[model samples]
Target: MNQNVLIIGATSGIAEAVARHFAEQGARLFLVARNSEKLQAISADLVARGALEVATFVMNANETDRIPQMTDAAWKVHGTIDVALVAHGTLPDQQRTETNIAYAIAEFRTNAESVIACLAALAQRMEPQGKGVLAVIGSVAGDRGRPGNYLYGAAKAALDTYASGLRARLFKSGVHVLIIKPGFVATAMTVDLNLPARLTATPDRVACDIQLAIAKRRDVLYTPWFWYWIMLIIRWIPAAIFKRMKL
Candidate 1:
C-alpha cells in the first residue's frame, strides 16, 4: 500500500480516516483542503504515523477554476497517483434550503458541481496514466429522493451517475472509477442527526471498506454492506405508497 495517493478534502472526517489508513500503510500522500493550518497539521500527523511523505495545498474546493491547478500540483509531487479520493461536501440544512433558493443553489454546487469539476481534472490525468483508482464519497441517499433530504440526495445522485459514465469511459484505459455509497456515518457533519448506532458506521470502518474496494477494483461500494439492501427496498417502493409514507 505504499502507493502515491491524493486526497482532496483531506481535512474532512471521512477523508482524514482514509488518509490515516493509507498513512499506516506507508503511502506517499498529497492532501488538499481549504484550511491551511488544518492541512499542515494532518500532513504532520500522517507523516508521524508512518506515511512515507506528505504534501499539501490549501484551496476552497468550491472554486472550480482552481481544481485543475490543484490536480496538477498533486500529480507533480507524486508522479503517479495510485489512488485519488474526492471527499469534500457540505450537509446543508434541509429546512433552510426549502425557502432560501440561494442557499440551496450553493449547497448543490458544493456537493455536485465542485465534485464534477474535480473529477474532470483528475480523469484527464488518470486516463493518460492508463492505471489508477479514482474514488468519490457518494451517499446511499442518492438511490432515491426523500422528503427529508432530497436536495442532498439529488446532489449525490448526480455524482453517482457521473462516476458511472466516467467508469465506462476509463475502462479501456485500465483505470478504475469507484463510487462509495455510505450510509449514516458518525462524522462531524452529521453529529446533530443522531443517526441510529446500528446503522451508522465509523469513519474508520468506511475507510477500511474503501481500501478493500479499491484493491478489488469494485465499481460501486455500499459500506457496511447492509445499506445496499436498504436502498434497494427504498428504490423499489411504488411512487403512490412511497410518497404517502414518510421516509
Candidate 2:
C-alpha cells in the first residue's frame, strides 16, 4: 500500500532521511518546513527517489499559533495522513540559556510547546479517522538532565511525557503515538558540539530505526538500541553521585 505520509521539519537532516526512506516505498508525501528553498529541494529529491507524490509547505514550526492551521492544510492536501512525524528542534547553548531566562523560555517554547501543538493538531484529525501513526524525534538527553545540556534535555523530557500521554489516549482509537529518542546524531545541528563519534549515529541509520518503529507501531523507542541500556545505567545512578558527576 502506498501510504500518505506527512513530515513536519522535513528539511532537517534526520527528517529528510526518513522522507527518502518513505519515498523509496512509494509513499505520497506532504513535507512542511520553515525554509522555502530547502523544502522545495527536499521535495524534488523525494520525487526523484520514487515518491508517488511530493508536496511542500513552508512555515516556521516554532510559531505555535500556526501549527494547527499547517496540520489542517497538510491533511487537506493528502486527504488523510497515514503517518506523521514531528522533527524540528534546536540544540541551545546550555550556559547561555542558563544565564538568560528569556532565552531559556524561548528555547522551551520552540522545542516543547511547538511539538505539543503539532501533536495535538495531528491527533485531533487522526482520532476521527481511527487509524494513523504519529511519531516525534526526541532525544535521550531527556532521560536524565545533565549540567551540559539540561535546557534541551528538560524540553525533550516534557515532550516525552506528552507523547506518553497521547499514546495512552490514542491507543484505543488506533492512532499510534511513537516517541523516538536518539542519543548523539551527527547532523549539521550537532556539527560543532564535542561528541564521541563512535557513539553518534547518522541520519540514515536513525531513519532505519524509525521505519521499523512505525512498522511495528511501537510506543517508545531508543535509537541505536544501546541507548536503552546506556540510559538505564544513567537513570539507575543514585541522585547524590549523579549530581556530583559531570555528564
Candidate 3:
C-alpha cells in the first residue's frame, strides 16, 4: 500500500490496470508512456481512484537513448521506487515482419532492444537502493520459438534471459527482479486475434497476479497460473515433432 511505483508504458492495458491497483492500495505513482493524452487520462483516473500521488512522463518506447533520462526523472519524483514495471512492447504481424528485414528489425527494437536499454539504466539506481522489485513483462511466447510469432518470441526470449541473469545479480543486492509471462491477455495489442475465451485473461486479473508476485519477491510469474504447466509441456516436446505441428 505504501509502495512508490514507477511504470514504463504506463498507459498499456496491463500497466494501466496495475496503476489502478496501486492507486487503490494508496501508492504514489510515476507513469511513463508514449501517449501524453492517454497518460494524462489514466493519471487523472488513478488520482481520483485514490492514488497518493500521480506523475507522468511521455516517451515512445523506441527511444532507447532517452531511457536514462526517464529513469533519472522517475527516481527524482519517487525517491526510491518499490516496484518498476517495464511493460511496453508491440505484437507485430508475423508475415509482414518476416518478409521485410527493416520492419523485422524495427519490431525487434520495439519489443527487445528498448527493454534491454531500460534494464541497463534502471539497474544502476535499484542496485544502490538495495531494495524493491524490477518487474518486467515478458510473455509465454518466449518459452520457445514457434512458427506463428517467432519474431515476437525471440524478443521476449531475450528479455527472459536478461531478466533471469539480472535476478541473480540483484538478489545479493536485496532487489528482486520479477519476470511476468502472460499468455493470451485481452489487451488492445491482442484485440483482433481470435483468442480462446477459456485461456484468455483480463488485465485486472493479471495486475492482481503481478502485484502479488512482487510482494512475495517471486523470480517469475506465469499469469493465469496454468501457463506454467502449459509452457512446461510445450517446452518438453521434442523438436522433431514440435517443428511439424502448427501452434
Candidate 4:
C-alpha cells in the first residue's frame, strides 16, 4: 500500500530525517511546520526524491483551535493519513527556565500541550479509519526527573503519560500508537549541549528506529536500544543517592 504520512514539524532535525526516510519509501507526505520557506523546500525535495505526493501546512502546532481545520485540509490532500508523526518540540535552557517563567511555560506548551492537541485531532480521525499509526518523538529525560533539566523532563513526562494512555485507549481501535524515547540526539536541539558520542544518536539512526517500531506495532521504544537498559538502571537507583549524583 502507498502510505500517506503526516509529519508535524518537518523542516529540521529528526523530523526532516524521518520525512526523507518515508519519501524514499514512496510514501505520500503532508509536512506541517511554522516556516513556510523550509516547508516548501522540504516538500519540493521529497517530491524530487520519489515521494508519491507532498503537501505542506504552515501553522503553529500550539494553536489548539487551528489543529482540526489544518488536519482536515491535510487529510483532503492525502485522502487518508496512514501515519501521523508528532515531532514538534523545544528544549529550553534549564537555568533560564528558573528565572523566566514565561520561557518555561512556552517550552511546556510547545513540547507537551501542542503535541497533545495535534495528536488528539489526528487520533479522532484515525480511529474511524481503523488502520493508522501515531508516532510521537519524546525524550528519555522523562524517565526520571534530574535536576539538570527537570522542567523539560517534567513536560516530557506528561507527554509520555498521555501517549501511553492513548495507546491503551486505541488498542481495540486498530490504530497503532508509538512513543519514541531518544536519549541524546545529535540535532540542532542538542547543538550546544556537550554530549558524549556514545550516548548520542544521529537523526538517521532515530528515523530508522521509528520506522521499525511503527512496522512492529511497538507501543514504546528507546532509540539505540542501549538506553532501554540504561534507563532501567536509572529507574532503580535510590532517590536519596541518585539525587546527589549528576547525570
lDDT of each: 0.94, 0.92, 0.93, 0.90
In the range 1-247, model 2's lDDT, one tens digit per residue, is 9999999988888999999999999999999988999888889899999999998888898877887788778887889899999999998989999789999999988899988889998899999999999999889999999999999999999999999999999999999999999988888899999889899999999999999999999988899899999999999999999999989
lDDT of 4: 0.90
Q: Model 2 TM-score?
A: 0.98
Give the winner by lDDT: 3 or 4: 3
In candidate 3, what are the lDDT values of residues 1-247, reduced to their tens digit?
A: 5899999989789999998989998999999999899998998899999999999999887888888889889989989999999999999899998789999999999999999888878898899999989999999999999999999999999999999999999889999999999999999999999999999999999999998998899999999999999999999999999999999
Model 1, 1-247: lDDT tens per residue? 4799999988999999999999999999999999999999999999999999999988998988898889889888989999999999989898999999999999999999999899989999999999999999999988999999999999999999999999999999999999999999999899899788888999999999999999999999999899999989998999999999887
Model 2 lDDT at residue 10? 89
Report the Cα lDDT for candidate 1: 0.94
Q: Which one wins on lDDT?
A: 1
Candidate 4's error at 214, in angstroms? 0.7
Off by over 4 Å in 4: none
Candidate 2: pairs in clash = none
Higher-ranked by lDDT: 2 or 3: 3
What alpha-carbon RMSD in Å does predicted model 1 have with respect to the real structure?
0.8
Question: Candidate 3 regions off by >4 Å?
Answer: none
